[model samples]
Structures are given as C-alpha cells and as structure tokens.
Target: MKSTKLYFSALLCTLFLFTGCKDYVRGNGNSNDRPDIILTYPELVSMLQHYDKTRKQQFAAAVGKDEDTRINHFNLKDLKDYIAYIEKECKKKNIPLTGINFISGAYPDNYRLDPKKSNYQALIMMPATTIDGEENVSFDPFKSEKGKPLSLKEILEGYSYTSWTYDELKSRKSKKKSSRSTQKGGGNDLSPAGNRTGISPPN
Candidate 1:
C-alpha cells in the first residue's frame, strides 16, 4: 500500500510538470502575431493613391472648367483650410500628424491660355509642405477686395471645415524581427576601411 501511494504521487507530479511545460510552450508558440493597427508602406501608398483620385474627381466637380489652364488657379485657400481641419481632428484623437507630405508644382512655360487646352497642360507647381508644425499654414489664391488674406475655413467648407484623423501605429513584432536580423548580420561591420580596402577579417 505504501509503494502504491508513492507511485501515484510521483505520477501526479510528472503530469503537472508536463502540463505546465506544454502551457508555457503554447503561450509563446506563434511569433508572427503583430498589432492590427500598424499598416505597411504599400498599404499606405495604396490609400494615398485612392485619396488622390477622389480629390481630383471632387475638384473637377467643384470647378466648371475641365481644362488644366482654368484649374491651374485652383483654390489654394480651400486646400489650406482642409489641412487645418485635418490638424484639428488629429489633435482631438491625440495622434501626431507627422509624415504627411503635400506637394504642388508650377505649370510649364508652354502652357497655353486657350480654353481648349488640356488641364494637364498647366505647369505643376509642385509645392511641398508637411503638417508637423506648431501652427497651421495658410495660403490665399484669391485676392480679396481689400487685399487681405481670406479665411481658409470660409473658402473651403463655406462655414465649417470637415476633419479626418490618420493614425499610424508602430508594430513591435516587426521592429523586433528587424532588430534581430540586423544583430545577426553583425551591426555596422562594414566600416569605411572595409569598403575602401576590399579585405575582410576572417573569424
């Protein structure tokens, strides 16, 4: 009877240890699990392309002139107001609106003044700006009667501007993988001497 009791106790202890080990292994099994909010560069590029298409359509609908020459003088005031609205929304959500780039290029010299000229014929202004400033920037394409700068909100949304938030979350899993790869590759092994003198040290 004593021998049987000792055997049963040893079995129970082994079973508990095995079960704990299995649980520990299962808990950390999958290394591919990453945050859902983080987006890849390709995903961001696709989104920006879609936004550009939508904006172009909206601009065409707003302006009766389809020719690039006529649209070349597009409402800079409205664009500024739109940016302001984006900033306000980002602040409300506590998201830093960095990495937002806007570029507008000037039209070329050959751009024709003819009404029949294609809208693409206008010189692209290629103006670039970002939303990571202390205060929102403003521009006025239209001159007021008093030559004063027009309020962007009034020009863009008529009265109140619409807002949108863009948050890009960082992925810890991806960052960790990148760090591991970098470490395995030997961080900063290729010094200036290594590049200039094609001789590498043998380990």
Candidate 2:
C-alpha cells in the first residue's frame, strides 16, 4: 500500500511539473504590477516568423513578390546583425520591454482596426515614470494628444495585443532566431520603434 501511494504521488508531481499555471492571456490584466516592454521592429519580425511561417509567405503573396523574400527583401538578417546597436538605443531611451507582440507589419496606418485582422501590429508599452524621481523615467509612447496618453485598456481590447512580462518572455526564448527596419537602424530602418518619451505620465 505504501509503495502504491508513493508511485501515485510521484506521478501527480510529474504531471504538475509538466503543466504549470496559466496567468493572464490576450492582453488581459493590468500592467500596474510590472513594467511593459515593446519589441523593436527586428524583434517583432522574428516573433511573427516564429509563430507563423505561413504569414510571411502570405505577406509576400499579398505584396506581389516572385518569391518569399520575408528576410531578404525585408532586410531581416541586417536587423539581427544590428541587434546590439538597437539595444543600446533602447537603453539610451529607457524604454522598458516586456515581451514581443506578434503581428504583421502590413498595417502601419491603422488600415485595420482589429490587430487580429492585420496580423502584424505589436504594441509594446513605454516605460512608466520613476516613483521617487517621478519625471525622470515617465514616458508615454502611445500618447495621441499633448497631455493625454492612449489608455492601455483601450489599446489591448481594441488592438488584441498579447503582452507577456519580461520574465515570461525570457522563458519563451529559443536557441533559434532574432529584423528589417520600420525601426531606426543600420541606416536600413524597417519599422518605427515606440515613441519613447522623456516626459511625465499625465495625471
């Protein structure tokens, strides 16, 4: 009886180990507890590629390309090569990155309202203000107006962004992978980085 109980217990433990708990999903939950990090352009492209290989091919087709030039035409490799340089720029800007938002870069002008519709619009949060020092690190990359910043609640629900905290994102990292530019880069910019601000978060 004792041996049977031990075996069962071990089995239960193994099952629990294999399946951990699930936190928030689909951009649900407040970021009050932790800082949010946005992925750079290169980072965004890598994630999209990781999650969906077909998307790139589809994107290429949509663009009337002869071949699937997701990396070559987009300058994905160049972005990867310049990853260090980009990190330095982020540090200088003090933009906190949490996780990569996986979406296509096809819709930059808000052509589609639902982020799910476009398949490419990773919206990373800019860093919040420093407490004791307040304005020192306060940033509002999503601000639509002079004193008003776009609400995260609104952004998540409307845009369908999947946000993971930094630790969670680190766990998702794989040995494979790393950008073309919409972001500022090797003079080969692919996408635009977030509007990292040095201003204070509005009251």
On a 0 to 100 scale, what is the lDDT of residue 27 in model 1?
37
Top candidate on TM-score is: 2
Instruction: Assess the local accuracy of residue 156 in candidate 2 as a C-alpha lDDT between 0 and 100.
Output: 36
Q: Residue 103 error for model 2, in Å?
A: 3.9
Candidate 2 at residue 109, lDDT? 38
- Residue 157's lDDT within candidate 1 is 35
Local error of candidate 1 at residue 81 (angstroms)? 1.2
Q: If scored against the real structure, what TM-score would every candidate get?
A: 0.19, 0.21
TM-score of 1: 0.19
Candidate 2 achieves a global lDDT of 0.38
Best by lDDT: 2
Among all windows of 10 consecutive residues in model 1, the one with the lowest summed lDDT is 194-203
Q: Candidate 1: where is the Cα deviation over 4 Å? A: 1-74, 103-203
Clashes per model (N, Cα, C within 3 A): 12, 14
lDDT of each: 0.36, 0.38
